[model samples]
Target: MRTLLVSLLSISCLHAIDHGPYIQWFQDPCHEAEIRWVDRSGFQAKEGEWSRGRGGFGYGDNDDQTVLNGMQNKYTIVSIRKKITLAAPANADDELIVEALYDDGFVLYIDGKEVLRKNSTGADAELEAPGGHEAKAWEKFSLGKIASSLKTGSIVAMQGVNDKLDSSDFSLDIRLSIKGKTSTDLITRSDSWEYLVNQIPEKDWRTSTSLPDAVPWKADAQYTLGYRPVGNGEMTWTSANSHLFARTESKVFSVSLKGLKADTRYEFSIRNESTKEISGPHLMQTAPETFRPMHFVIGGDMFHTLPLLDAMNIRCGQEAPLFAALIGDHAYTNNGNPDRWYQWIDSWVTHCRAKDGRLIPMVMGIGNHEVAGGGFFPENNTPTPDKADEFYTLFRMSSEGSRVISRYAVDFGNYLSFILLDSGHTEAISRQVPFLAQSSANRKKTPFLFAAYHRPAWGSGCKDDAVDIQQKWCPIFEKNGVDAVFEHDHHTYKRTWPLTAGKRDDANGIPYLGDGAWGVAVRNPSKAELQKRPWIAKQAPINHLIRVTLAKDGFTCDALTADGKTFDSGTYPLRK
Candidate 1:
């Protein structure tokens, strides 16, 4: 029987007072409330005048001041009745975040004592004040520590005390969320492995015919680790820094398998030594020298938007793939501000968890939009200065210097390999040519070789016709026997035939998929352009996502549109 899980928010369990009748709630639980004084006569604060606080609340905007008033005999708390429940975690390291909005000054008490205090009343008062108000609201506060204090079924309460002299429309909004341990919650099963191709001697593993640069062998390079539980025993394998070429250096990285029972469920994760952030405890089942049919999802260019996120969630629910490859443009950065990236990841953390409450293992690629001006031109290019900086900081991607630009690859068991490439802001494609060539040669054992980058080699929406792909990257792709290429940019869907240099379709050419319709929109591809390109096989004007299934016969690809239509479908046979 298949298990079904649904995530729901019960507001009554989150707060002590019920303010639902007076204030409107925002979709993002993290945001502060937009209080409108519904009482008509305004709020009467007798205790003291409501003033601003120091840090305000914990919301993103620091300019919003929190309401503050001292306890006085004249003050009567105009109660905004709301109840907040504390999130109890199954594990110890779990974190809970909370945000509240108020007019004037306010204090947070756990069991009737001050845990957090805010008073934005001085010259700094203007800085903490929320935008647009005679009396601004407090900034949203983040209470990771508070989450740690919660007992499973504890009552979390909040009181919005108001001063007597100050009277205006009073209201408050509250949000509570919990994040569990990052790497300790995955399901793993163990199986014994059998070698497929032993033509190359075991001692000569470094000289094998796999793509050379595809595997990084640097001693300092990061690695992914996990344990497979089989009954009463567990098997741990720290992924070897498999080099794409024999000439590449070797690196030492290992995964730990612990406390796992043989043939039992366990979890695994990728740890980046450089950043100390864990990738996942994503689920995987192991079989002894046998194949377990696997499924996964791939798509990119998701700008922060609720409707698109909702659609993606629905699609994932329907497909129920084991993993998702977010091939770049996961978030849009306007003017290359890094704060936007933080917001984007935070948004994902709040919404993108799986039905089982497991964080999906995301294989991320860099998109043009992630860079400074969202393009490849030198004028538009401004590499993020720190390697393992903001963006990479959150998702443990390898970095060269301060820039998160590096060639990386991941093997799905022994059948397929995903080569994630960076194509924005930093160095041109020419710089990574060596790595690309090495990646192609390493695919002999892995029948399926998929590559993804930011911009497309061929697309219809833009009249330029994927100039960058044509000029700089096509040769590299053709030189290496890459199977399919995933590209994002146009905010509309388009797929191309396997073609060689220029545009002639070739039976042996590599197929190109995508023009990134994840969350943004653009003008439809013109009929003239569509007709002009014979290699163009499919197109969709709506937001859509791609699902790829790998099997023994070959591979199947389907494009599912936002409205739940399968706009395109095709099968690519394995190389003979």
Candidate 2:
């Protein structure tokens, strides 16, 4: 079968079909790109010691294929050159397509003439100095019809510049193609995203792989995230929501698609309006207007090793749940590092798709690791939004804005509610009391009201009971009759007997589940520790996620391990 598959692929490559509405000439898919790179100080006009490697050259970020060591604190620029051998070339009507991922900035040259640049400044004849912009996402540029410059064979060169020699990280990657009329659409899972030239001028036309920065109070584009919904033969472009990342000033934005029939599947693609880059033909489903059986997976300590997280994510995807509630410690960026967030988000998008290809919506909460400096603060100083900038920015918590406050509540019609809390990560635990009290009160009639936060109030694996949570929030949870509370941060699996006022109350108390072992290394509470905590009903040392199925009168919880094996299960009646 393997041999037959290889043979079939080879045969398909031999015969090219005219896939046109627009003319396109892509680099040979099988060709290994020959890239040479060297530091600026070591560069010699055309003769210098250069190292041979593929594209993506830099260090400090995980994206690099060729790691440039010692580049930090020594030089701010690296010279990169690639030899391109086109199958055919030299057409005035053909535009040379250029896509680059660069930190600081860079200038692209073909046959020693400057064709494009970004975050860089210098004359055409000399290397451009670095600009101060950190790399956001891949930037796309269409160098219109390079017939006079590009021939059958040309040397492509770039000076990958860094914002500063002392910068923490640097990277540069380049992709080249040729297209007539316009470049090929950025193909995503569900659609072919074509670029429309008239939207922006060719020379000044630059688009990001991610959404552009949010436009302030613009009617059509109000958010940091932007999208153009492609359907039938027309495109409706709109943008909504905005949450700012303090470090890069990049906002996470969204575009809303409203007035959909309940329980119906819809397809849409995400596109950057400015750069004309598009991704997705992703799937989504609306909730039924009437009550129905549904389930959602919840977990925390979400990111550890990539393989472990991916395995668990893939399993969760297999469940085809309506959504996922990642309580906290997501990405474990630890210090709000943008690169780590990039990796984590990419992984989730890639692995968390349901078998039917639906993109699972995420409900998030703040945790200790989400904040820089380990989520601890002096008694008088409460943790603030700026401290957990990445978390607030990457995930929009409310229409008010991610930076407004970490605690918020979301309802699924009138059947279910999720109260996401800060748990001392971004806001004081005591400060959350009033908010929690009111949030729980508003959801008193909700059939399945649940609370999720990072720290545990009745922890099984750790000694500290998160006293503040017990004192300030527990009373509110019990008073308002929250059905259950999800707790994380201890890295162990736990389920507690229903407790109303710090003591188990089988009939009226709120049951607490989870010690947040998601993708992190799991811990086993010693026999002594379990014995000391009488409220504990069950415990395990395993990476698992909780799949909660909500019914009309009750919900069922199943704890599945990393490989999707059900190790524990229980059913709880909805609190009256």
Candidate 3:
């Protein structure tokens, strides 16, 4: 009786484990499917199974006897057929998380390293077993790892093994999510180059193509190339002599130009391709031969408020920086629709043009709002099918169709490198921890370093509660000598005193800035909470934007509120 009860319990567990949705099967080892099966005995069935009663059941009865009276024992190998395609920006740090449910056991591999292993058994086994011999089952296992080192077009795969005696009765289910660097690297030297330029009318510019000149600039005119000499500085344009045409859908136009120097600087201007409305009286410097100073804007949690965008536009215009880094929460809610995203893009394109009419480039990191609303509890929500399919497509990144190479380093004169990380709505921080450690070594090339993400590591505001950042990401930052970290999420202004491990506020420690106040309302941090956390250097109830100016002496950071008030200013000296 005791033996029978034990067997019954085992069978019951197996049955429970097997009772979930079915994942497709795959034959290629590199495919991103969750289940795979190989049949050894040549027994064929739509689904697989064998009946114990067919051969008459008895204590310790062998189901093989029924199959082998004149036949041979059969084994069915099952595997997942679906694949996970990671969308990562070129050269950016990223991670991939794969979750699967299967019968028996599973082995996960990324670039062929076994990352996770799991086995399941029980009374439920009988219920899931083929013909009631001894069923095998497993369910829901998660595996995560950094994708930074992965090459473009690399494949990720998962394999499952079941010890069932029959060639039939196999099942599995699998899903995947990725975070970080969804945009492809646009600065690479290649022939197939597409340019998206913004042409504001009255802003003198010239173009290669002659279309019925759109909104901003007119068509067909003799545009002049303006120049001025200042000090010993040489004027150069990063992009010049490009074909220009306005984009019908978006507010920006595109220019494609070639025949220029590599790692060299030249100044050029654009006039209406047709109207000859010369748009540039300004100058841009090209990438350096080695390492040069690269500048970009960082902020997040912006709702579709035009006023906030206007402020940012004005500041950015005055600053006239290179790129913009948005730490997620782009649209109000739901990553399902493209309307909000498009609107946001249109607004930026319209207002944030350079003096020469170039639309500022954008690099985005995922946020809770970019995924399914709140990011902490992600399992309950699945990406809407169509939206999920289109999300990566709209963004110009190598995050689709088996590409690897997430997490990019923008080398600004080999002295400063900005590492953009993804911290929400996808994989957990733990997976990318190792990559963060490795990134520290880059300080040798770029002595000044910083990291940007969507969520804050430390917070004093009531809404600033992100446990994952404190636990998983903080240590990496501290260990890496990351000069500072910029984060968004909470809608107020706060800065951390160079901190180590959330508490020790050492001058050498990593400082954290932000709580995303782009367009969001501000909430003050209480005195009691502020007192408890000494790492907070300054906390205020204001909506603001941060600007960093890098020079040979040191870098200066200014936190300016929307109304152009300089709330805080600090400088980070270059490390010896």
lDDT of 1 by residue, 1-576 (tens): 112222221122012111111111111111111111101001112222222121222122312112212222333232211122333343456655555555544444443334554433211112132222323432555555445565443333333433333343333334455556542211011101111110211322211222222221112334445444323345354652321111111111222232333223344444445444444443433221223555667777787575776567556545656556776666676333443443454344334445554333356666766555556654244365242233443344555665556467765445667777766445566666677778667764567788887677687656455566577677877776677888877778777777787565557787888777776654486787777778787777768788888778778788887565787987787873
Which TM-score value belongs to model 2?
Answer: 0.63
Clashes of each: 81, 4, 75
| Deviating ranges (above 4 Å) for candidate 2 | 1-77, 80-235, 240-244, 249-253, 258-260, 399-403
Which candidate comes out best when scored by lDDT? 2
For candidate 2, lDDT tens digit of each residue in 477-510?
A: 8888898999999998999998988788888988
Off by over 4 Å in 1: 1-291, 335-343, 346-358, 379-388, 400-404, 502-506
* Each prediction's RMSD to truth: 21.5, 17.4, 26.6
TM-score of each prediction: 0.56, 0.63, 0.50
lDDT of 3 at 454: 72
TM-score of model number 1:
0.56
- Candidates 2 and 3 compared: the better one by TM-score is 2
Candidate 3, poorest ten consecutive residues by summed lDDT: 50-59
Model 3, 1-576: lDDT tens per residue? Answer: 433432343243222111111111111111111111111111111122211111110111121101121111333233211112335433334555554544445544445555665563221112122222232322334333454555543434333344554434333334444544453321111111111111111211111112222222112222223222322355333322212111111112222223323233233333333333343332333333343454556677776576776677556645556555666676664555443454454455445555544334455565667654455543234333223222333332223246422244454455556676656445446655666677666563456788877767687655656677688777776666778788888787778887777775666677788778776766777788778777778887777777776666667677876666789876777763
- Candidate 1 minimal-lDDT segment of 10 residues: 35-44
